[model samples]
Target chain A: MRLLSFILGRAAVALLTILVIVTAAFFLTRLAPGGPFDAEVDLDPLVRANLERTYGLDQPIGIQYRRYLGALAAGDLGPSTTYPDRGVSELIADGLPVSLRIGLAALAIATAAGMAAGIFAARNRNRPVDALVMGVASLGVALPAFVVAPFLTLLFGIYLSWLPVAGWGDGSLRHWVLPVVSLALPQVAAIARLTRGAMLETLSADFVRTARAKGLPERRVISAHVLPAAVLPVVSYLGPAIAGVLTGSVIVEQIFALPGLGRFFVQGAINRDYGLVLGIVILYASALILLNLLVDLAYGWLDPRTRTGR
Target chain B: MLLEVSGLRVAYPARGGEVAVVRGVDLAVAPGECLGIVGESGSGKSQTMLAILGLAGPGARVSGSAIFAGEELVGMPQSRLQGLRGDRIGLVFQDSITGLTPHMRIGDQLAEVLVVHRGASPGAARAEALQMLEVLQIPEPAYRLGQYPHELSGGMRQRVMIAMALLCRPALLIADEPTTALDTTVQAAILRSFAKLKAHAGTALVLISHDLGVVAGLADRVAVMYAGRIVESAPAEQLFATPRHPYTKGLLASMPRLDGPPGGPLPAIEGQPPDPAAVADTGCAFAPRCGIARPACMADLPQPAAVGPAHRVACHAVEPA
Candidate 1:
């Protein structure tokens, strides 16, 4: 009964949050300086009436919101304004994989690099080694990816002439290097700082002293006791990070000219593609919810103290 | 002798300069002998115990020698110290709840010490852990091993700590302030269990605490430290019945008595210990705190004076520098 209540509670909140975000997104776009067809050429006078009736774009804002919510309930995301024949679901389905793929890859790399760097910094506290790694973390935090992207491109793409500079390639290892590096730097900084802070605190805990007294090897002491204890606070740090990488992959997709969803979302926004815009908004919300779920799961995994609701 | 600590001095850089916390303290423990080192906080009783286990923190400049079964431990590295701690010299910490890992099951944690020291197979480690818990007088040892630290009461947790320390049948057991934080009833049970375990293993025990009452019933011999130095050492009854040093007399008087009249002033020592800077100097640190201080007490540090068989004191005024 308790677990059932927990799941129900989470699902209810997620449903409410999704409704608020989708509805707010729909109306906020309408509040923008122009209508969905503002940038397009003037429609044929006779067929314009037919277009309005078919897509329900002719209705007032409230009615349109109501219609949108109704269709959403029925699993009907209306056809894209730019491509009237292509359903909204198809557009979303096509674009989502690219963003989710990069998000997951970046998550894995960031977790590994950050955890190692953090452990190193903690093990070598108040030393030259910690100074070097923290210096890199500061650089990662200070410089934006726009600056990092071009520099990385110049070094790997132009100077060494090793990887593709402006575009993602087809079916090859050559394609993944540029965008992956661009996406990884921000996460590395974030995770390393979080892990370092948490690990430092954990190493000072009384259990750590007790572990030493138990005669366990230093590696086992840090790995089993300190790392697991340290990872607890990093879960909260992951919340915003999940939002950043998964939702903010748009810039990277544009820089590398990847055929990912971020590029499609940007183009849709620029072209004022109404159905595609809603599709992207919904996709962003979904990513936020799922990543948060993963974070919550990780919380239960890392700390049994948290699991018992203490 | 199972454990012999001769001329052991635990020094480190104090804020001003180098200072010794446990200064030139010597002690020996035989099989099944319990030696209680009694003193107030910052008296270096705890530091002396840690010095024996080699658990003092970094840059803690130590010298002289700690020989357990004739193996020297003055400048031994941490790896060897780790090996010796559980397998040869089991260390029982003060705080039970904080000592046990909050997240780990009691059984798993118990099994861990045996596995690390004895390399017992998992099943054997688990079985031994359960048996040892039973030995500690923990009710339903097998069932309780699956429980987390918070699930058990304070006495139960301390018992678990004792069980972990005794699992390998170590030659020397160093327990620092074991019952200091516990209530009176729980304290009795923990002490009873310690006595039982000490007998079962024939382990030489070093019990370090500020509480004289806690050590009085357990100790065969008691060493009383004052301001980073052992000011007095004697057999338990001799120390209690006729405390030679004024500081030891003050400590015994300070304990809440069973025989004294009800609701009276507890005898407290007159002053706190010396400054950490002043403590490390080669002068008598406890002279300021000593009630019977003579002019000669502050000029120079006192050497150990032989009072009786196996009794020693470092006091210029009392022991004659």
Candidate 2:
């Protein structure tokens, strides 16, 4: 029963958050100076006015907001201004799955590699091995995806011909490799540093000392007692970490010429396709809220003190 | 003897040189005996026990020998040391609140010792865990099996920690200030449970604390530590009746007596215990703080002199009486 209420409360908050995001995106996009039809040609002023009227842009801001909310209530994301025949929801449906697949894959690679590096550094702390891990992680963090992406392409795609330089792969493992690596490298570095610090702190906790006192092997003591506490901070960080990965995929998809949400979001904002932009914002906000909720529930499960609110 | 430790020294590397925290201390615990090590904070009492079990933290360098059940433990490989841990040597720590993993359920934590050390099956381990809780006099042992450490009160959590340590029926148990974090009444109750468990299992116990009253109640013999060395040792009653070392005398004198002045201020030992790094190898470390420090005490380190059949004192002013 308590779990039920907790989840219901989170769901309610998630809905409210999505609503606020949608409202803000709607107003901001509309307030931008030029309409989607402006850059196409210097058409007659009367023709442009008629086009505005046809798209409901000539109506009062409040009236347009009400109509948009009504459409949203009926599960309609409305039609795109640039691609007049394509609905906003239709565009999203086409792009979302592809974006999600790549995002999930990158997140998996980041978490696995990051945790391994962190644990290795912590186990061999203050040694040459620890210094080596931190030094590499620092370099990874300093190089942004744009710089790393092209460098990787040049090295593997052009120099050695090891992996494909550009374009998303078609249902093959080789296709996703470069994009995923470029997207995941920075996250992996950040997470590794976070885990290393947390692991060191957890190692010094009294419970860890108690475990060692039991004469348990160092391996068991670290894996069973120390890791659980250390992993908690990483779990909390995963919420924002995941959000960064999703947003980062936009740039990655554009650079690689992929047909994911990243490409659509950029095109929508440039073309001033307000409905499409708002639709993507709503989706991203919802994903963030849900991911954070899941993290909170998992955190409570791992540390019982959080469950009781003590 | 269940355990014998001789010439045990634990040092940690610092900026200039390594400082020995436990300096060549010798101790012995007979089977089924409760030996209490009494000292102020930083006196190296706890480090001595940790070094014996190889639980000292990083940078700690331990030397000399620790013999348990006829096996040398001082330089034993960690793998071999693990085999004796939980199965033959149990340890309970000072703070019950942080002594247990907050994430694990009480039953699983207790059962893990048996499963990991004795290779007991899950079903059998659970049964033994429940039984151990009952032996510790915890109410509703079955219900508690599902609860986490945070769900229990301070005293209950301590009892659970003790139960976890005793699950494999270890031959020797080391409890370091086990009741220090509890209230006076809870401390007494926990001590009572310790006494009962000791009688029931006949486990040799090494109880380390700064509380004279706690040692007087449960220990068969007492070893008084001062600045990384044992200054005096005797049967508990004998040490209290006639303390030889001036430091030991000061310790006993500071304990509030029930039959003494009702409204007077309690006596306190002046000055803090010496830092492990500042202790010199050539002279008595306690001489600067000792009330009866003589010219000889300042120049040379005193060696242990037998005062009675079993009583020993390490002080320049103390002569065999």
Q: List all candidate RMSDs to the true structure.
A: 2.1, 1.5
Sequence-dependent TM-score of model 2? 0.98
- What stretches of model 2 exceed 4 Å from their correct place? A169-171
Q: Could you report the DockQ of all the candidates, in the order they appear?
A: 0.69, 0.73
Model 1 error, position B293 (Å): 1.4
For model 2, residues A1-310, the per-residue Cα lDDT tens digits are 8898999999998888888888888899989988778776797989889988888889999999999999998999888887788898999999998889888888888889999999999989999999999999999889888888888889989899988878766746777888899999998998899899999999988888877766677888888899999999889889988988888888998888778889999999999988888888888888889889999999988889988553
Clashing pairs in 1: none
Model 1 has a DockQ score of 0.69
Poorest stretch of ten by lDDT in candidate 1 chain B: B275-284
Local accuracy of candidate 1 as per-residue lDDT tens digits, A1-310? 6556766888799889999999888877777776556556886766777777788878887898888889998988877887777888887787676666776787778778987897788778879989999889988878767778889999999999998887655626676777777788888887888888899888878788888888888888887777777887767778887777765588888888877788878877876677788888887887788778778867765666566542
Q: How high is the CA lDDT of each candidate model? A: 0.80, 0.88
Model 2 alpha-carbon miss at residue A198, Å? 1.3
Q: Write the per-residue lDDT of candidate 2 for residues B1-321, one digit (tens) a residue.
A: 989999989999999989989998998999999999999999999999888777888878999899999999988888888888777998898875788888988888887788888889988999999998888888999999989888998888888888888888889999999998899998998899889867988989999999989988999999999988999999999999999898888998898898988987888778888888889988899888877888898889999889997999998887876
Q: Lowest summed lDDT over 10 consecutive residues: which window, candidate 1 chain A?
A: A301-310
Candidate 2 CAPRI grade: medium
Per-residue lDDT of B9-101 in model 1, one digit per residue for the tens?
A: 888876667877877888888888999998878888888777766777767888888888888887888899899887788888887457888
